[model samples]
Target: MTGIASHPEIAATLALKRRGITLTLLTTAYFFSYMDRQILAILQELIRKDLLLSDTQLGLLAGFAFAIFYATLGIPVARLADRGNRVNIIAIALALWSLMTAVCGLAQNFAQLLAARIGVGVGEAGSSPPSHSIIADLYPPEKRAGAMGIYSLGVVLGTAFGTMIGGTVAHLYGWRVAMFTVGLPGIALAILVKLFVVEPPRGMSDAQIVAEGQDKGVIPPLGDGFRTMLASGPAFNLVMGVTITSLIGYGHAAFGPSFLQRSVGLSMIDVARYVAPVGAVCGTISAVGGGWLANKVAARYGLHAQAWLVLALKCIGLPLSFLFYASSNPYVAVPLYWVSLLFVSSYLGPSFALIQGLAPLRMRALWAAVTLLVINLVGLGLGPTAIGVISDLLRPAFGEDSLRYAMLTFAAATPWALWHYWRAGVLLKRAGA
Candidate 1:
């Protein structure tokens, strides 16, 4: 027998060894997914200049066009995850997206680049929903926020690696090569996940007190789980809140590199070095710490954790958002942006964990996919495009300052998002969640 099979428990000191391994692989996979997606934002300045693209065109690529396919496909893929072998599907997606990323490096024109990005969108459509499903299967309710928080770390770390690497390489070699560099590594990692991460028993991460009362080894029907979430007011509110927040978040994502380039006069390489790492570190801290704190708060105050946490963070973040947009100094704006990211990044893990806790086992992927659909359609699909359109419209009058105002306008969406979270908190109590 192999070492793992021979020593089923592996090390005595390690607790929930299987869960640790599963989540690690899932997070790493997500790291590459985010890495490939984010590299473009870091390299935007170089790509825009070389392609001679308009802001509107860039926004379309970054926002609506990519997100349209990405969000639309997620549901079907998630439905497949509910019923089929998730690992094989995820591995295929990794390979497809990695190849598409490499293809992006080969584009010589705006149209070609747009098409390549769409390819990337199609490939990425397969990742998150299945991973969410898998996570719900591996860890228990109490551990989920921490687990998802660890998983959420991939967003910042991947962005850091992608941005820094893409920026530096683009600085040295050009943006094209940077695209290829960030994407190719995921192909290998996909194979590793398929080989090592076996699917755990469904609903293992649920409230085990409930699980213990039921018959062992029964996989709940996927439809039943979907209906559970569909009827959940708190869950629905949380999804909408996150989706709205994502709209503004994606706007920042679409134009942040360009903001630094036009406003701060940093070259692409400087963005990777100065901007990417800063956002990455802050974002990771916010995501992981937010989950940890949410759990701590929940233990004390119950489901009210996210409500208070989000309120405090948003109140602080709103001001930082203003500062981020108002400041012209990279030194000031960069750090301020990082601070804002800390708050924004914190939402994902806690929010996702909340959804997992609310929904039944089989439907976890479906609900995740459903949330992604709304977020991608409304948030990513419109945020960048709206900003771009507005910026272009303002350009004749405001000139270079147009982009700044457009970004500030999008930041206004945060308050509404905060309100939704607050409402979700109230509904959570009503639902007895």
Candidate 2:
């Protein structure tokens, strides 16, 4: 109050710095989260060789065993975040998963590895929901996509580096050492977050905060949150669209290294050196540019236009993904693969922003958790596992090419996702959202 009479600009500048710093730390935590999760993709082959594990077992380790717990635990943890200190929750989660990821190296058997991965998932369960809630509070509905998009850079960058670093390390030092390499740094990040990130009042971005209290109304029951999230047609369709996309996305992520190695004859180090850079650059563009572009489109055309962007991206990307997997030439395949990633990943910012915009103030974290629940359970839980099993089934006939064809089969069903986005667009437009 005293400052407002004299130097308001200083307060504003300090506020901006705080917001930027918090977002950076949260995004960094997210980077480690996805890195810990996706690192398994590049290491699967080594683990399979050392453990004498089948692709199906590897897929379960990579997907279902982790996803089932992560998705299931996220809801309750999110409910906690909606009321508790979200900064603390996120910090604790980062520490737990980072430690679990390191423990992954110590596993002597399949069951031991599964348990470690399950712990990783459990820790990761507390990650995104609270982060999403915090982001929603920090940025208003209009700018949220761009903010979320910046945050989502963690996903692309993390996935890319997971392969680049993991692949290189696996080639040189082996998979266990790679796990330890990626996992330990997150503990320090957790400390930074715990010390620095501040929890904003709930509904602050929605202009619902008041001095007497946050004044956002009572925190609703779990059932109420479920209803609030489900009542929106856009929410339903958007969640399903993301879920379907994830089914294909996670499937490809789990096996893509294998396909590149066996079908295209790329060495592990080659993928790290040559292939990962393509994804890193293109995916960075998509994550940052997609949100900026969507914000511009939404400003001019309204929120409905965001859905249209997603629709176009998917429709264009699916064909390119087909070409990426089918091609034999590294120059051709790598370029196509990165472009497909750019297109498919561009939807994340717009979709997540829409979902968050639609949520009730008190239930945002729960809503995000529910969205993750279905997406992770059905998509992450099944995608890689199904692809792995399918690859095995086709192994007798196709040998090394089974993983490629298995991924393609998953890709064929992507049109279902496009339809959902189209329907969501129609609904948003009709509602004038």
Candidate 3:
């Protein structure tokens, strides 16, 4: 036989290997990014009690403070990712967010903790956009959905580990200790990423260069990114759909542990022990499965398949979410929550894959940043805060049941988001045709 390097099959296999390594490192970084973000949800009760704060204050801390910085800073960071070294950007960001997360453990007051959380957001701002751009370069359109689905597992795994580890550690030690434990590991992960992850050439996976005949050496103006995205109907609709979904998802997630503790009469330890695992498994199945199914469907049915799947999943999830919070028994409510999370979690991979597929290569990172800007600002920034305000409003009448009702009320908006997905799918189908 000829030398292994001279064989075409061997070269293809090696390329796949490099892609796998890049995806694995990026996904791991994503895991820590989300763990640091979601750990606060599990520990909110402890923080509130220790800090002597209200639910509304806790909501602001969980939602607005982090999201505002994350969303705003994402644009500039994404610009940097587009023009400079994405690997370096991600590594430095991972280190910054990880360090800030550790500093959260030292907070003795609300202001200090809030500041640290914002710092975490600022650091995490650099993570997803660059990662998305890199993944798009590594995988061609046909495989991107499945690859993105795998990457989206960071959401499920992060939430799972955050709840499991944070709750267990807080129960054993304290919330501060829990934060330190989860936070410090990411710094080392950052160093690993810098040392090992290789950056691919932009547009390497695309069938045609989006910037054909343009200077590959020069970065396009920032406004060019916005113009390109706004000019695309499907891209705009995808952003709207994702933002609304995020509002509902983040709101529910922010209050879910507390809801179980208060509504189902479970202790924090119990919520972590039973509910966390169920939610994690359900979310992982839905995210990975949805992406895989979408890719298979898209292979036959075309680009609209992903959007149609999202629409269907949202439609099914709406009633399930209502049922989950409405039920009083943990046995009944937990299963319902699992089903609801399954459907809702499916949206991330499909939505993200669609964004990358639709956006031009030069604009991919910026588009991702813009999508996140709206999602974080409206969804992450407003969802928890809205729940908090509504809960406080209903508290005088419903007492502890207020949060449950608040979450249920937010679930009503899921159908609204489904409409956008439907519209987006129709547009995508037309564009493909």
Candidate 4:
């Protein structure tokens, strides 16, 4: 057993089934994390009325309260993951966040909710970096995107369920009940993860290691993750591209329910029934299909082709987003929303798989952590807040129409993100892919 464990190539066939189980459990964990985080979005209108909080306050709860701790704490947590037992870290983190999510339902005021959200962030911070590392070790570069696409479905499915269930529960009972509804099940899921998933040897999936220029057994210093990421021009651009992309994506996603309710006169029930289901279905197709499509493109053209694929997805989504927000008609906006989600959600698999491939094998978790720190701190942390502030500024002029234009304000920045994707592709092509 020890001999086989030491030899990854020899063990690959035997480990294949375990790999599937691990990925499934990890993806399910991600789903719950996102669902817990996103539940507040569906319940925000009710929360606002109950707590007498402003949009800015809600944004703080949604963005700052969560993203700050989630991003900052991730660095140390990821460092631990790189050297420690990733399964234990994931299970412990999942349990912590799940408990905090339930606690969020018990909060009596903005301050209490703020603390609970922070706890949720702290727990979630430990999840992704390690999970990224694990996935990278389980699948090679060619298949990584499709695997990542499957993993990224957590975001799509989580967001869908978050809105659907949160809205339904909040509509029938109250917001507090909705929080508990999504929060408790994660604890049991955490246990399942700890029991079912086994830690694979680092560098198990990679067939070579010229990029690291070091022994695979040597644990590189923490700074190596940052240096390694920046060392590659394409990788740097990919990271920046995702950061920009997520900024706009999180903004629209967080505010979407509010926009429909406030502007289109859709109720919570309407959002759950009419909007959430569309996003789930379209985003699922995009997430899985994007990875599969990028893989086909990469196999035919080169891995660099993925950049172009993601760029196209972003371009398609940008116009759809503008039309979605601009239209006052529910019928028009809802369909546009579905189409926009299809294109926009597809970028995740292609881009994330690229970043994981770019990182050094031993330092993948930290590399992912550093990338996430930037994305969450600047993108997720500010996206919702920016939208809220802009909406507030536009409220006097646009009145109830402020959120629609506020979302559009961020959607215009999609072009800047697309430029990064184009640059990343150009750099990768120059390197001969």
- Please give the clash total of every predicted structure, in order: 1, 0, 0, 0
Instruction: Report lDDT per candidate.
Output: 0.80, 0.88, 0.88, 0.89
Clashing pairs in 3: none
Which candidate number has the best lDDT? 4
Tens-digit per-residue lDDT, 1-433, candidate 3: 1243245355445545688888999999999998999999889989988999788988898899999999999999999988877889999999999999999999999999999999999999999999999898788888898999999999888988899999999999999999999999999999999877766666767746643643264677889888888888998899999999999889988888899888878888987888888788998999899889889889999979789999988788888888888999988998898888888888888899999988767788999999999999999999998899999999999999999899889988887899899999999998882
Query: Which structure is stronger by TM-score: 1 or 2?
Result: 2
At residue 201, give the lDDT of candidate 3. Answer: 64
Per residue, candidate 1 scores C-alpha lDDT tens digits across 400-429 of: 878988988998878888888988888887
Clashing pairs in 1: 139-205
**Runs in model 1 with CA error above 4 Å?**
1-16, 207-228
The predicted structure with the larger TM-score, 2 or 4, is 4
Residue 318's lDDT within candidate 2 is: 87
Q: For this target, which candidate reaches the highest TM-score against the unseen true structure?
A: 4
Tens-digit lDDT track of model 4 for 185-267: 99999999987787777776775763454544777888778887889999999999999999998887888899999987889
Q: What is the C-alpha RMSD, rounded to one decimal, of candidate 2?
A: 3.4
The residue-level lDDT of candidate 3 at 108 comes to 94
The number of residue pairs in model 4 that clash at the backbone is 0
For every candidate structure, what is the RMSD over all alpha carbons to the true structure, in angstroms? 3.3, 3.4, 3.7, 2.0
The CA-based lDDT of model 4 is what? 0.89
User: If candidate 3 were superposed on the true structure by all CA atoms, what would the RMSD be?
Assistant: 3.7
Query: Model 4: which residue pairs collide?
Result: none
Candidate 3 residue spans exceeding 4 A from truth = 1-16, 210-215
> Model 3 misses residue 59 by how many Å?
0.8
